[model samples]
Target: MVTLRLKGLHRVKAKGRIYWYAWRGGPRLTGAPGSPEFLASYNEAVANRQSSDSGRFRSLIALYRASADYKKLAESTRRNWGPWLDRIAGHFGELRIAQFDRSDKIRPVIRRWRAAYAETPRSADYGMQVLSRVLSYAVDPLGKISSNPCEGIKQVYSSSRSEIVWTDSDIAHLKKTCSAEIAQAVDLAAHTGLRVGDLIRLSWSHVGEDAMIITTGKSRHQREAIIPLYQGLRDILGRIPKRSPVILTSSKKRPWTVNGLASSFSDAKKIAWPKGDDLHFHDLRGTAATKFYVSGLTEREIAEIMAWEEEHVARIIRRYVGRQAAIKERIQKLNEARKS
Candidate 1:
């Protein structure tokens, strides 16, 4: 037997199995050691780590990508940030990290790069956010920068979705026109107020006699969102067949991936409301909040259930419930006038 040692090749043992990685905390290498497939993967990972613009933003970005800080981020967040990181690298890769110490010098440049995506304000803002995270990592962990220039940069996109709850008409039309999967998704979202990611991951095990309990996917604190088992939610759950451990399944009876669910929902939206006002799957959160408010839940109680700020819950009630309450009052007045 021959022992082969390769530079930067790391080996580890865990749970009675040995594993090989390209480098410590780097990408895992597959195939038997010394095999062609293993060598190829190792080489690719090493090649990616070599930065042509060393000591510059490109190198910093590379280091950030490999750091636990980046890896520990939510999978969806990492996926969303990947492209923006590339864009930041392309734009500022050659700029020396020392240059970022001066906020005035780097802030304007970042803003200018952000302006390129102004037509899509949300994308523009997201790009800024991703860039900021990388730079923040550099400042704290790497000590490459004196300060983060992205601080206090005003986001170009401002949105108030208080009025965006799905109406009964919209839900009815969606149920009639969309596929069963999409209809169930909408119903589950409206009733439980779970984000799409959480909704897709919901299972029968999470349901209790009085409430559904699960850790929210996007919560930084991994907080458990406890939603009471309302009749509407129970009815929606009763109608769904237990094809998989996950409550929501695709048309093929497999668990729903985020992209899979979004693509299908987008198509369903077009067919179901071709001429109607815009509605998003996320709006169902507001719908659920409204329902909770109308059912006599206080803002603080709804906030706890939804894992949202109490202020945000209040805003949802003021927008949705306030209008409904006013309408009910007007109808009562109309009936009284008719009697007079």
Candidate 2:
């Protein structure tokens, strides 16, 4: 008898019957060990696994990861995109580049994959965005595909938060109910109009006599955000003890992580509001924009300070200041009628 050694050949015994496989959980092999049919199946499976196009999605993803375009994305953006890229690769790794070029054929398949996370519309949209970016890269620099199938796909989630501004009462309640750290965090965010990530990363060194000038984190230090130091902001800053290099620290006197601060804020919100707690930390940006409008800052100035579009600044003003003007006019009319 002769013994034959085979790579990636797996054998299983079940119910008193022996079965051969190319590998565990891989295609089943036909015929006896060393038989022509068995060898053929094993060779075919191994060849498929070794083919360049077997992991075409992964290969494209690798090229994109190394490309200058992907490298230029903000650090936080890249971090958020990492998992979605992995999911795309996992779902489509075995596909050929030619298949992606057939937009009609591939679009339905991509949609089906996206539909799996339909319950999480935001997440699904994010995944779609990542997939679209990858496919766009393939279309342009790689030339592996003719067009992006994800182009012009309607996003499932839509929201309008223009009217959502944090009230003074909401701030007072948060300050009263939450810890000193969280309270200071809220005040800093309300005054500076910084995003949560930027807020946590703000340092005392960024503060100057007239204004706090620092390049925004989201801009990858390419654009500067200039926040004026008003009396209210000065008062808030004067009260906070600098325990770390960063202005806002955890209860442990360490720099705040984004998730840590968000979790803390969420718990504080639950305790303070208990119900009807629709306000978010991001709403502080809108509140600060409203404050800027009231302080006589032009729409352009406010937009520059907050790195927002002028149209967005105008919308905030309309929602808050315009409404106030309407209410004041109504009251004046009522008072005049009473006097008559």
User: Best candidate per TM-score, number?
Assistant: 1
lDDT of each: 0.82, 0.80
RMSD of each: 7.2, 11.4
RMSD of 2: 11.4
Count: clashes, candidate 2: 0
Q: Give the C-alpha miss distance for residue 14 in model 2, angstroms.
A: 44
Native-referenced Cα lDDT, model 1: 0.82
Off-target runs (Cα >4 Å) in candidate 1 are: 1-55, 141-146, 159-162, 179-181, 219-222, 239-245, 249-260, 293-304, 307-340
For candidate 2, the per-residue lDDT at 272 reads 90
Best-performing candidate as measured by lDDT:
1
Task: Note the clash tally of each candidate.
Answer: 0, 0
Candidate 1 lowest-lDDT run of ten: 319-328
